[model samples]
Target: MDNVRIFELAKKLNITSQKLISLLEEMGISVRSHMSSLDSKVAEEICRKVKPKAQEKATIPRSQEKAQSRTSEVTLAETGRKKPVQVSPGISLKEFADLIKKPPSTLIKILLGYGEMLAINAPLSEEMLALLAEELGLEVEVKTVEESLLEEGEGGTPELLESRPPVVTVMGHVDHGKTTLLDAIRHTDVVKTEAGGITQHIGAYQISYRDRKITFIDTPGHEAFTSMRARGAMVTDIAVIVVAADDGVKPQTVEAINHARAANVPMLVAINKIDLPNANPEKVRKELSELGLVPEEWGGETIFVEISAKNKTNLDDLLEMILLVADMQELKANPHTRGNGVVIESRLDKGRGPVATVLIKKGTLKTGDIIVAGDVHGRARALFNDRGKRVKQATPSQPVAVVGLSAVPSAGEEFLVVDEEKTAHQITAERIARQRARIAGPVRRLTLDDL
Candidate 1:
C-alpha cells in the first residue's frame, strides 16, 4: 500500500490527485509509480487505510472572501495576469514590501483588513502568504508527498531567532596598521599569515569580543574604496577610521572620512600608534576635528578611542564602543525569517569554489539555504566564520563565508534566501533585468569642474 502509485491512491480514496499528493507530502512519503502500473493489492490496501477527513471546502472564509477577491483583482489589474500569488515560506513583510515596491505600512493595512494581525516584524501566515503571492503574481501550491518525505529524511535543527552582526569596514591610508589592527583584534597575524605579506584583495574576518560578534571587511585603502563608494554599494555598516597619533590626519585620512560620509555609515576614530614615542593623542584629535569628526569628549558626534594596535592597548574599549554604537542604532534583523544580508566581498577559492563573505543583517543562514546573490543563485553547502572556522549556521550580526553559489556574486550585493532553487533563479533573473534597465537608461553628464 505504501508503494502504491499516487494517482491510483487518489482514485481509490476518492480524492483529487493534488490533494493526495499534498497528503503524502505531509506524511513525509514519496509516490513513484504511475496509476496504470499501480498494483491492485497495494492500491486497495492504501485505499482501506487512508481516507480524507470530513472537513469544510477549501475556499476562502466568508469573512475574508471580500479581501481575497480584492487582492486578486488588484494583482490582475497591476500585472494583467490572473495567476495566484506565490508566497515563499519564511520571507518577512519588510522584504515583501521592498520586492513589490509598496510601503510596509500599506501592506500591513491591507493584511490587517483581511483579519491578519501580523506586525511589520511578524512572520506571514499561510493565508496571508497566499494573499501576498496573489498580489505579486506568483503561484501557490501545496508541497508534494515526495518533498515532505525528503524533509523528514533530512532531520536538522531549524534556524533560531538571533540578531545578525554589522559589517564593519576599516578605512585609512597606507601604513596605518589597518591590517595589523584587524590582526590584533582577531588575534591572528593574517597580514603576515597570508602567503605573501600583502593582502591582494578584500578579506573578511569575524571576531568575537566577549559574547558579541563583529564582522570586519578589510577593504583596499587605495583607489578601490573610492570606486566602490561611487557605485553606491556602500557595503560597510560602521567605518573605523584609523588615524596615526603621530601623523594625525593625512590626505588619505581625509579621503577615508569622505568615503565613509559618502557611504553614510557611522565613523569611529581610532587613534593608533599611541604607544610610539612621538605619538600625540591631543594633536590627532585637533586634526580630526578640522575634518568634521569631532570627538565625543569635544562635544562631537563621533567617538574617538586612543589605542595602539601594536601593543594591544585599549582594544577592549574599542570593541565595547563598537557594540555601543550598534546598540544605539538598534541594528537588528529577525534571523528566524529568511536570509537578508549584505555581501562584503566575493572571490573564487581553489578549494571551496565560489565563496562570498556575507554579513547577515536579519534572519539566520544555515547549510543548504538556497541564496540569491545579485544575478547569481546557489544553495549554501559550507559556512566559515571570519577566522576561517567552519560553522553550521550564522545568525544576525554574524559574518560568514558561504560556498556553493552558481557564480561569483558582486561585492556589496544584497543576498536573500528563497524557499526553492527555482524561486532563487527567478530572483536572480529579475535583479539582472533591473540592472540592465539601469544601465540602459540615460547617463547623467557632469563637468570636470564639479570635482
Candidate 2:
C-alpha cells in the first residue's frame, strides 16, 4: 500500500507508523496501493513481514527479555537495590526510556517510587538513571571525555554545559562610583565613554587576570538595579558590591546587597573613593556590618577592599581578591570545547546594527560563527574588545562586543555557537514562537495604586 495507508494500518495495530514502514522497507515490501484499493494478499504479506517473529520472542525468557524487547514495557515497581541517577546535560527522559526499550511513563513512575516525584516529561538526571538501572539490573558507568568530546564537531553538545562561568555583578547606589569601578577594572572609560557620561543601559565586561577570566555586569541604579541584579543572580558566580567610603551604605547600596544575598552569590565589597579627604573606611565597614555584610576581618564571609577609581588605588588588591575567591571556588573550564558565553548586555548600535557584549566563558568565539542568543540568532561578523580593538577570536574569560546580529537580544541572554545557519534559524524560530505564546496570553496589569 501507499505510505499513508501503511501508516494507517500501523496506527490501527498500535505501533509507530515510522517503525512499521521501516520494517516493511527492510523486508523489501513495495505495495503502492491506496488504503481502499490495497489487495488483501499484499496487505497480509506486509503485516507478516513487519510483525516480530514468534521464534525471536521464544529465544529469551519472558521475565529477563520481555521488558528489553517491548517499547511499551516499564519497570514501575522498584527493586530493593535501586541506585539514584544524577542528571547531566542534553539527556531527556524519553531518550533514556528508548535506550531501555521502556515507556517514559513507566520510567517516571519508577523514579517517583524512589522519591523522585518527577513527571514523564521532566528532565532525567544521572542519579535517576542510576536508580532505574540498578532496579532493572543494568550497568551504570560515568561518561568518558572522549565520548562527550566526539559530539563537539558533530554539533551534538548539549545547550547547558555541566560547568558554567561564575557571574559577577557590580552593584551600588547612584553615583557611588560603581560604573567607575568597573571601568577602572576593565581599563575602559565606559563612564566617560558613554554619550552622557552615565551608564544609561546595563553593560557587561569581562576581565582577564593571570590567565583567568571574570565577568562583570554594570547595572544602572536610577532604575532600581533590579534588571542588573536579576541578570546577576541568573548567571552570577559572585558579586562585587561597590560602596563609597565617603557616602557609607546608602539606600540603593543596601538594595544591591539584598539582591546579592537573595541570589546567594558570595560578595566582595569595594569601599570606593578612598582618595577622598573625608573617606572613612572603618566607618564604612561598621555601617556595612549593620547591613549584614560583616567583612572577613570581622569574622564574616564577605571580603572588603578599599579602593579609589580616580587614582586607581588598591586596584591590584581588588583584582587579587576576586581571583582568590574564584580560585577558592575552583573556577575552571575546558577551553578546547565548543564556545559558550553569556550576554552581558544587548543594544541597537547606531551604525553597527545590533551589538552585544558577550563574555566568552569557554572555548573560542571566532568571526563568522553562527550564534544564537535567546530568541535572536545570527553569525558573528566582527568582534571588538573593551579597548575597541578588533579581534579575530576570543578565548575563555574574555569579553568582546560583537556585531551583525539579526536583532537586539535581551540583556543577560545566554549564547551558543552552532554549526549551521539552518539549525540556528530553527532554534531561533522555536524561541520566538515560545516568546509569542508567553506574551500572547493575558497579562495582569498592575495599577499605580497597587504599588
User: All candidates' TM-scores?
Assistant: 0.60, 0.59
Best prediction by lDDT? 1
lDDT by residue for model 1 (14-38), tens = 5545565556557565643222234
Tell me the tens digit of each residue's lDDT in model 2 across 322-373.
7656544545454545677777777888899999988776667899988888
Stretches > 4 Å off in candidate 1: 1-166, 194-198, 222-235, 442-451
Candidate 2, superposed: residue stretches over 4 Å from native: 1-167, 186-188, 208-214, 222-233, 441-451
**Backbone clash count for every predicted candidate, in the order shown:** 17, 14
Q: Which consecutive 10 residues in model 1 have the weakest lDDT in total?
A: 152-161
Q: What is the lDDT of residue 251 in candidate 1?
A: 84
Minimum summed lDDT over a 10-residue window in model 2 is located at 53-62
- TM for candidate 1 is 0.60
